[model samples]
Target: MKDIILRLNKLFESRIRLGIMSILVVNDWVDFKYLKETLDLTDGNLASHLHSLEKNNYIHVRKGFIGRKPNTSFSVTDVGRKEFKLHLNALERLIKNI
Candidate 1:
């Protein structure tokens, strides 16, 4: 339980990263537009946060032209899914124990 708690704490170390992770857990894939809309973040703000997550290998980017416009999509990787679930489970366990 202690080890799980430590790992979960690491997973949510940053505010923006934590929010991004929570969103990814629920949605298989999300668009840049959707993330900005849902989180009420500016373009630069969202892009930077997404980049951080990508750098950490927690999320993957799929960029392409949607018709004539550029579109960026994000999907959580397999490792990310496992870690996020573990974080969630740890939180639930800790709460239940309390």
Candidate 2:
């Protein structure tokens, strides 16, 4: 149990981050507005969390323009996918142990 707990990724400890990763893992590309609406997070709040993940190289951010409007999208990287899977496995182990 202790070993399994240690396998949990600290980056995913926050619900906000976990939610972000969850959405990114399944989607190819997700726009800022879509994530904000789905997660119901304020701009600043979401930005801060997104920044954290980006800094860690867990996600990739793309900035572009769509019909004269600036668009920002996110996707999970290979490293992120592997790490998140390990974290989820740890969580599953912990639950089953309990």
The candidate maximizing lDDT is 2
Q: lDDT (0-100) at residue 87 of candidate 2?
A: 93
Instruction: After the best TM-score superposition of candidate 1, give how far the Cα of residue 51 lies from its true spot, in angstroms.
Output: 1.3
How do the residues 20-89 of candidate 2 rate in per-residue lDDT, one tens digit apiece? 9999999999999999999999999999999999999999999999999999999999999999999999
Report backbone clashes per prediction.
Answer: 0, 0
Candidates' TM-scores?
Answer: 0.81, 0.97
**Model 1 per-residue lDDT tens digits across residues 3-93:** 6567575746667777888898789889999888988899999898889778878898999888999999999998877877887788888
lDDT (C-alpha, whole model) for all candidates: 0.83, 0.96
- Which pairs clash inside model 1? none
